[model samples]
Target chain A: MIDFSNPLHLLAYGVMAAGLAFDLVGCIGLVRLPDVYNRLQAGTKCVTLGTCLLLLGVLLRFGFGSMGWKALLCLWFIAMTSPTAAHAIARAAHRAGYALWKGSVGDRYAEDDEGRNIQPAAAADRPKEA
Target chain B: MTALDVLMLGLALGVFLCLYRALRGPTPADRAVSVDILGVLMVGFCAVMTVATGKDLYMIVGLAWASLAFVGSLALAKFLEGRSFDD
Candidate 1:
């Protein structure tokens, strides 16, 4: 049983609760979002933060013991990797010709590709060299 | 029930939601995204288990899981891009 009288334990409980809520909300978004990109946006950001917070709670609970050090290490690993993975997935999806949702506003990657292939328009868009 | 128990139950529910998305997603990318999220959620579960069991091993497991998940996601992305792995 956790000692609720300890300030650290209380803090750990609060942090863990917040992390749990975030995880649930992120998963809900994953299920309910309209498109792949939308789901990726929601799931990656929220879940990464949630998991990091959960690890932080563990660190708080254990202080500077071995468990706490390991929790902190895990926290760093997840934080570094999650967003990079999300970006890679998004880029791959786009390159694989996955269509954006009908309500999507812009595709910078497509625009860049077009500019690269059609130099005249790209040149025209650029300022004239004096 | 203690807060840890509630936390574990909520995380389990979240895992189910992720599983639903992974299983029923309309596109491969959606499935991939859900799988990535599932990996992250598992790390959280490991953390909770560490606290519940008062063990350090779960944290090590979470660390290894995070690394492997990242590699798997990157490989999936490369496969989706239709590119050679070396590229």
Candidate 2:
């Protein structure tokens, strides 16, 4: 049996627990959020952090073995990609005209039928499309 | 069961929760984000399984999966960006 008394084991266990909690909470947010933008934000930040922490725990547990090295590489890969993926998804969602939540305060991307931005000043002149 | 095994179990539960989100998400974009979360969860599972089983191959599998997930997400995003994209 593995020695749970070891400091490394304890640390890995604790980090993994924390990562799991974060991941669960992020999933909850994804399900309960009112809009795609909010979901994107939650998924990008929470999952990236949770997955990286989990990887850190793995590195600690595995030391300098191939598993550890691969974990390290995966961590870097995720840290770099998750946000970019989120941004791309969000931009595409916005361009696709996925409606914002009814409670949204403002829409900077709102455009008139003439392809003009619709701000407060242009509210009266806003075309029918926006 | 060892602590690592329990942790892996929890990670699996988390993966299921992400799947639920992916299923119930209202819009294509929302679903896309769910997919992102799922990919990350897969990586976490891979990490835990490698250590628990004392195997090294799971790590490489996790890395390759992550790379593919990234590319898939980008392609999905591009398609959404241009809904007219046919190919």
Candidate 3:
């Protein structure tokens, strides 16, 4: 029942195009970035933005319908969950003793997670200097 | 240019970039995230493609695909976290 020639269709498509552009840039950043933290930032933010745009497009194209409402709901769920998952993964990596890239300029978590300071592997293996 | 066509081209380029990252990522987590993101891009692509081609029925499939991506990401994140996070 939706009208293809409606002005909303044009607007929807335009939003979708913009979203895709942002998603492309995010992927480029993901490839270029040095480590997980940086990549997570890029991937989470860009995909969220891109998908939102796409969902808007679909909603408009379909008008008020089941698929349209479902698409919007999916978009909402993604927006809520993706970043939370990213943060959880990053936290686990830190807790598991995965070292960050040496070239990383700053680290707030370094101060917060003092347990990481224990030199379990290298210090344990080396003979005493005395 | 028609809006749908332009959006389709743009999304196609985006998907290509996501695939590039998925293939080239240095670590397992990085690759997983890239792949997850790619799945999202695919869902979007399908939706846009359906609209562009006047195939309205495919919209439901696209929604399913997008929802599956969330579950996929959650699983991968748990896998990446391994034992400690679960504890």
Q: Per-residue lDDT for A63-96 in model 3, tens only?
A: 7686677667767766776677667666655554
Q: Which of the two candidates, 1 or 3, achieves a greater TM-score against the reference?
A: 1
Candidate 1 chain A minimal-lDDT segment of 10 residues:
A120-129
Query: Across residues A9-73, which tens digit of lDDT does each residue of candidate 2 receive?
Result: 77876887788778777877777788999888886798789889888888988798878888899
Off by over 4 Å in 1: A117-130
lDDT of 2 at A78: 94
Better of 1 and 3 by DockQ: 1
Model 1: DockQ against the native?
0.91
Model 2 chain B — which ten-residue stretch has the worst lDDT?
A: B78-87
What DockQ does every candidate get? 0.91, 0.75, 0.47
**TM-score (C-alpha, index-matched) for candidate 3:** 0.78
- Candidate number achieving the greatest lDDT relative to the actual structure: 1
Off by over 4 Å in 3: A1-5, A115-130, B1-3, B54-56, B84-87
Fraction of native contacts under 8 Å reproduced by each candidate: 0.95, 0.83, 0.50
